[model samples]
Target: GKFPEISLDDYECVMAQVERQYNIRCYNLYRTYRTTKVRPIHVAPEDWQWLIDNLWSDEQFQKRSKQNSINKSKQEMKSLVGTINIETYEVTLVRNPETGAWPSAVDVWRAIYMKANGTWSIPNGAEILNNLEEAAETHKERIAAAPIPLAEHFALVLGRKPNHSRGVGIGAVNQGAQERYRIRARAEAADQRASDAQNQAAALLEEVERLT
Candidate 1:
């Protein structure tokens, strides 16, 4: 009888399966399982640790993974009050009642502190947070009252439509917007084809049932 110590290749193979099954990085699978003491629904509970230990030394056992497409959509969402600074690592909010969408932390922080009244001092973080929370509630209520349909809402969430907190259907196509929109179109067409296929299958089954 022989027990096999997992090779790096085997560890990678399992991580690939975990990624395919759960749509997550191997690192996340390891961390979540360790911290929560709960089995990830997408991965086998038994081998999680073994995979973690074996794969930890690999350079690609990344600490932070790329934001997946869905999270990218969420990050682009305007309902979120503030953004994480990619460079200087500051969290900032937009206070302009006119524009709810502020994409850059440095620009916003400058507008509020550096140049607004020729003062180089920034306001307290809590003040900004409170202001945005109020604005967020108002925005939520307004969007709720708008005439957007459920189907259109799904499109917005999926990046089929542009990320618009203030305006719906405003997909100001960036450099790759056309490509993404095309992909969305293809996916929609595929979904329709799937529905048609399901219907045909059901009808065929019903006809067979009748014949028998």
Candidate 2:
């Protein structure tokens, strides 16, 4: 099919007809060109070329950046591992002179350290043995003559209770003292009641004599 070419006058007339039908204004075709105050659209060839080059280089930079980040993470992990790798020492179990039994230096040391660390339970054998050996060395004399009751020896020497529950001599003494105190209190109370009764009986006898 052959298409018809319309002249500028015919095109303008058609636009005017459409605008009139639609109740809108059409662009003027006969305006003269002038240097008006307006913002100009500027394009920089250098910047555009730079952006194109950068877009191409971005893949390499991103790959290197990702590798660097992974390397940094690996280095941090290695540092952490180095910090956590602690050396453990060997400890021996020696006979406690006071208790007359084998006392593990590791157990004692571990107990002390655990206590310091706010833990009540016994620590691993290695740590316990290490601490006990240290303690035994510090107090050699006390360890030599192992006392029958380890706890009592500790109390006597240290002026307080020992962590190990052995030979608590004061428990019976404390219980006896409490019983004696209770008995004394009861006796005092009974004496007071008996004295009051006697006083009442004497007053009753005096009243009877006066009436007679």
Candidate 3:
């Protein structure tokens, strides 16, 4: 019996499927599976090890991966419409047959907002409708001058940032904020280490004086 030779295209297709299935990419996937001792369904343990040893370990790849994460986090306006993405919704939108004009982001948001409105206990929820109406009018005026995305429209009109922590409405994780939090956590750890070292030194000095 002989194993079939895997081509580059086959390898790439498998990797694509793995990414889609797991919602994770190379380095992170390696880290997660390695630490957890949980085997990935698609990748054999030996193949996973080979991938780690060969590809994910490269310094340039790791650097690029980190930068990609940072770049992704900086994108304030997440183009999501519930389970479906904005792009999919855009394609499905009923266009004006005569004008060939498509529905704007705000128009899509309004529909999403209606469905989600009753789910979460929004702060001053009753006033949201009034605010939305006002925002719509403002958005129309603003767009007449210059166009903006729905997330921006929400921020400008309704005063809601497109981060889940701020409020609910097709929001995304604020990656920059999360990065800042990690920085602060690291600083706190350093401070704790310094304090522990100082305390240990003091204890040693007291012990030496007692011995003398």
Name the best candidate (by TM-score).
3
Write the residue-wise lDDT of candidate 2 on 1-212 in tens digits: 49677645445555654764553211110010012322223525564445446742478855765685564343221111131101011123334679845434334334333445455332343443444456556766764554322223333432433232222222212333233334445656889899999999999999999999
Better of 1 and 3 by lDDT: 3
Task: Report residue 180 deviation for candidate 1 (angstroms).
Answer: 3.3
* Worst 10-residue lDDT window, candidate 3: 164-173
Ranking by TM-score: 3, 1, 2
- Native-to-model Cα distance after best TM-score fit, residue 73 in candidate 1, in Å: 14
TM-score of each: 0.26, 0.21, 0.36
- What is the Å distance of residue 168 in model 1 from its true position? 17
Q: Please tell me which model should have the higher TM-score, number 1 or number 2.
A: 1
Residues 1-212 of candidate 1 have per-residue lDDT tens digits of 49766645445555654655585465466557557857677777557656756764445644333234334444332222343322112123323557743333234433434544554443443354344445445455543443432212223333344443222223233223333334444656889899999999999999999999
Candidate 2: segments with Cα more than 4 A from true spot = 1-159, 162-173
TM-score of 2: 0.21
Under the 3 Å rule for N, CA and C atoms, how many clashes does model 2 have?
19
Over 1-212, each residue of candidate 3 has an lDDT whose tens digit, in order, gives 49766645445555655664575555567667557957588878898787778867788877877796664454323322434333234335564689755455556554544445344233443465566567667667764443223434445544544463133232323443233334445656889899999999999999999999
Best by lDDT: 3
